[model samples]
Target: MTATTPTPTPTPTSPSAPHHQPLLRPMDLAGLRLPNRVVMAPLTRARAARDGLVPTPMHADYYGRRASAGLIITEATWVSRQAIGFADVPGIYSAEQVTAWRRVTDTVHALGGRIVMQLWHTGAASHPDHLGGRVPAGPSPVNPRTRSFTTTGFQETVTPRAMTPAEIAATVADYRAAAHNARQAGFDGVEIAALGTFLIAQFLNPRLNHRTDAYGGDRTRRRRLLLEIVDAVAEPWDGRCVGVRLGPYLAAGDLFRPDAATLADHDELVTALNDHPVAYLHLRGPDRPTPDARPDTAALARYRHRFHGPLNANNGFDRETANAAIEAGTADAVSFATHFIANPDLVTRFALSRDLATGDPTTYYGGGARGYVDHPVSTWQDNPGQQP
Candidate 1:
């Protein structure tokens, strides 16, 4: 059987009503049961402890507070030290991170919410300022044209040291270990960070990955690391425990790359991942919900061609556009980021066509519960005259 139901239409909103159960239909992946298709894309807010390695109680509360989503994906948690691209970013390679994440997973589970941790590596996108002035590493030595998200503000992106063959092998091991930690953390599963123009993305894009070695020259070689990581991480993970997010030519940060030559390589990738034990492919398209942004349509369709798993479509998808994509058979599910970040009861709001709570950028990156959990549920008090 397929991952999602054979429904003819995506969930629709009743204009006259305030709210209803969001597209609540069940789907199965691996062994985990997804009560609904709405997923929380992994958002990178530096709320972790100072070391950028530990999961604090607030992190648990932060996730637990938004337990109403169909599925919750944790922030881009690193799998190894070399993969640590940002300060205060969490990692799963450490025993302590595993222990700390356990608290978060337990809390979310207590709320009857399902969550997944995204395994990440920043690559050339990392700044020296963020990592003890250490040059970040990537598939090549090329520097990124983007800036880093610093504690106070944005800092310039710097050229990173390229990885040796030995380092690449070790990096693969780190991902395998992180998968083990994710299971120990009590998460429903883990998703590999192949999106948002991170380390893996850096390698996959020819524009950034200017190398003649087996790891770069062509799309076949570029996909080596990504494919290997998928196989490695799935080795020990249980439940419906694996997903991958791919931005393709996403224009976020310094992660932009065009799809002119990488198209066929992408097809091979999707075909390969589909044959694996993976559960879903999280994809991005043009329009980041914010204006003046261009979407990556070629990358969006790449996943659909060969991937048979549940497709969680993201990027600039409003309620209307999201449903349209689903109804049109473009994506099996849709992950809402900024909207999910602000609205704890997003599913409720979407169900009724109610006005979503305005997301505050002030507290978006790193802050306490101000914009995180302070948003009220869609009850009559907050949005009166609306059905609960």
Candidate 2:
């Protein structure tokens, strides 16, 4: 990553320039038309109001500034109180929350941007503090041994109480309600957060789930919870407006490892998703690739070969590599996270081949306006009067 430095504003150029041509090209995701192939990945800023877990004006301004991307996936949002684990993250369960998010969607739409909400549930990755002194619920009683972002900051996770069949049914209903709320809030679509060690991912991992009931044990049973949620969430807006995110290469210490069996499980999961009518399958690629690794062995390519739907690749993709991935037919589009933080005009910067600004790590999460909306956009030197 390059350090942020002051540079003279360069002249503005056409976004359809030859550089990174594949990334600048227009794309149609489901029925949604995107101006470019660069999608903004969902990033957790934890900047919502602490009182009701509602999005504030700061969130609206923050997302409104980066509306140039083809699609913006808002930060992971809690679907219900039981889905909460982190402090200050927004939720979509309340009427007040829906109103607050409507402001955000309106701002982005006013600027000609397409946006979606990422539905999330932390499951065992939660602290008792966040759950009102009660242990969080998960598929089993196993502790992930991971940390949770509570009001008191990061705390060691405790073994979660196993959810009953009735509890599972209620949780599925929660997802359906959240999707309805998102639509009411004026979002173009919703993406299910099944990545990492979240609730859905926990159910998918054989090591973390030890239940002998219908929701656990072999691959077929383990995937029941996720499939059920998918079906439930699609009830509101249909599968064409929904996207599913999967992270097969995400490893967290000894609890969740990207071993052969884990990869095989995800391979099966991706193949099974074809049975559903999801708009797209978002796959998180490897964070760090070995120098000897071939493009065919990459997570994006591996899953692209399995899933027949449109594929959106994420994680550690730069302009050149993102274009290459699309050029090789391994990915239909690429989603960027870190880059969008410092460069609100990331699409324009990539179009003109300008140097990108690096984000300040200290202000990445839970902050005021400085690092959130103060990042400068590239200006046109030819038009000295133009402002960024």
Candidate 3:
């Protein structure tokens, strides 16, 4: 997530015109120099091995093809079985998972693309069937508004049992180990999935957390878990290798944070991270039919004063909009979620101002490489191998 003020300034479509480089060119976030500003936002593709949550060789091929972007953050990786909210999502807790992910990271690097794993825990959204018959955990028992994917079938999210103090400490440890496994998997870094409806976000949301402990109540205490996780992940790892993603305003995942509290935590977290050494802050506003979900950067005008680090703002950003954001200095870079799903060589296509392939929603998730790895880069018809 990028450091933002209340108002996010838009960048020029082409800061350096004539040559027609990408709307946002390659940039250095902390110490990571990306070839372009369009980050491959982590999308859930449940292709991991059925039993152990291990990544397969196909995962390597899948990510290696899209190495043209500034960075590729892999899909949500569950920190523990209790965190297994999504079917077939990868994991970093087991040695087998680490080994399998190593292939993915090596493949991406061999192809000249850097990758990061998005560490995640589903909290109350997790299903009992998915976690050794255990009930899901959250601030309270508030279930997700929508159905969550389970191993057996889609189930209604249940009110989860509140966790004990020891449980919270254990989760923090889970994050630490996941970070360690991420390093062992040879990843460039890890992104904290504090965004959306993950466990950490649940602990921070007052509407959901309704707890009386230090982890609940006010916005400042609510954010304690996320901040600690960030700091925990950064403890033994390089500061530049840790990134965090969250949606301050729009409710994605299972969380719908209040507008004012969203703004407050945004400032607090950024300020707290000012002294720490994290790579980037990945901020997502609402996307799709609704644009402009990013929080009021103007409210956080002081975040710039406190945190002077890399910011990657994500939403429904196109080439033109992304460049505008960069030029305005609202964000150091922009992230593309759907755009990259269809355009394998999105950077080149954007640089040349070529036509982009429309992404197939059906193939976005639950499918094999059919829609995952086979998307065309340029003219769909030009690539003989892309035909479904």
Candidate 4:
């Protein structure tokens, strides 16, 4: 069925009542049973072992602390060395990387939490600094004019070499191998990172993908890479255990502007996903909407009728709005990024209606234990009569 297929009725709760939060309800995401609908959105902390691109012991501690989340999507992980865009981010292609991620999954599973690894390829968003001075590969030779987070710091993006048919085939293999590694690492599932201007997204965008090959032409050809990756990933794990993230309205840094054609392409893409056994469609809302604006919610609703599977709304979601989205049936679940960073026990905090701790921006990326795992949990004293 497509993402627009009607889902089972969610638990009935008053959206206005804080004690009756709908986000705390259980959900059956494809085949994975989630305790609550509050999913922890993936956040890149850049804390992996720089040399081997392996996850560290700190990753276990970090993810383990946020085990209360119904589902935790680990930070964007490189599928291969060619997928490298940001410095210090973990990769799943190596044996050591798989072993390291196993520790993280074990920690989260031990705490009774479900977790998924987000597979990523930065494409033109990458810098030569991260790729051993070699230019990155993309759908076309177009330069996104974006910046990449390098070891030295942020570096300007350079024009990427257009991927050949053989190279594209190899990249697809890389994603399949990565999914297999994630399974070996004991993750509950894997999320294909197609959001923003990432590699898969770069191929999906007509503007960035200027190729005259079969992978270019119409919207169907443009989305061929993403579909191929999905089919390949299913070889390692069932589509029921796989999720796809898409950013139809991602206009960050003026890179991926959502024009009529682009938006229509996304609509077709979402509809086409129904043919696959995808567990859920994770849709990112508009970029940087105003605090009071429910544009994210509106954006999700716009596509709610297009997709038939379970829909996970992301970007700038909070406790109340999340509950409202669930109540309104615009989203099956909501994923939180920043709120989850500072409040590891975010599920519990929402249960108790406790104030959340703000994360330290300075130590957000490429940091030690400070901003990574040092966020404190709320005490029982902070919420009297609330059992957490």
The best candidate by TM-score is 4
Model 1, position 304, has a per-residue lDDT of 83
Candidate 4 at 256: error in angstroms? 1.1
lDDT of 4 by residue, 299-345 (tens): 78878898888999998777888888898899999999999989999
TM-score, structure 4 vs. true: 0.94
Please write out the lDDT profile of model 3 over residues 1-388, one tens digit for every residue: 8986664333443343413344446677656788777789988888888878888888988899888778999888988766788788888999899889989898899899888889999988777778777788887878756567867667877778898878898899999899999988898888998867768877877778887788887877888888788888887586568988867666655357447766677777777776766788887754454564544444323454456777777777777767666766777777787888788888776665566788888777675778888876676455444312
For 31-124, candidate 1 gives per-residue lDDT tens digits of: 6677766778788777788664688888888899778777999988988776766667788888888899999999999998999888988778
Give candidate 1 regions above 4 Å deviation.
1-22, 238-240, 253-255, 288-302
In model 1, what lDDT does residue 213 have? 78
lDDT of 2: 0.88
Worst 10 residues of 1 by lDDT: 14-23
lDDT of 3 at 95: 89
All candidates: TM-score: 0.88, 0.92, 0.87, 0.94
In model 3, where do residues sit more than 4 Å from their true spots?
A: 1-24, 252-257, 288-306, 379-388
Clash pairs, model 4 backbone: 2-308, 2-309, 3-307, 3-308, 3-309, 4-307, 4-308, 5-308
Q: lDDT of model 4 at residue 324?
A: 82
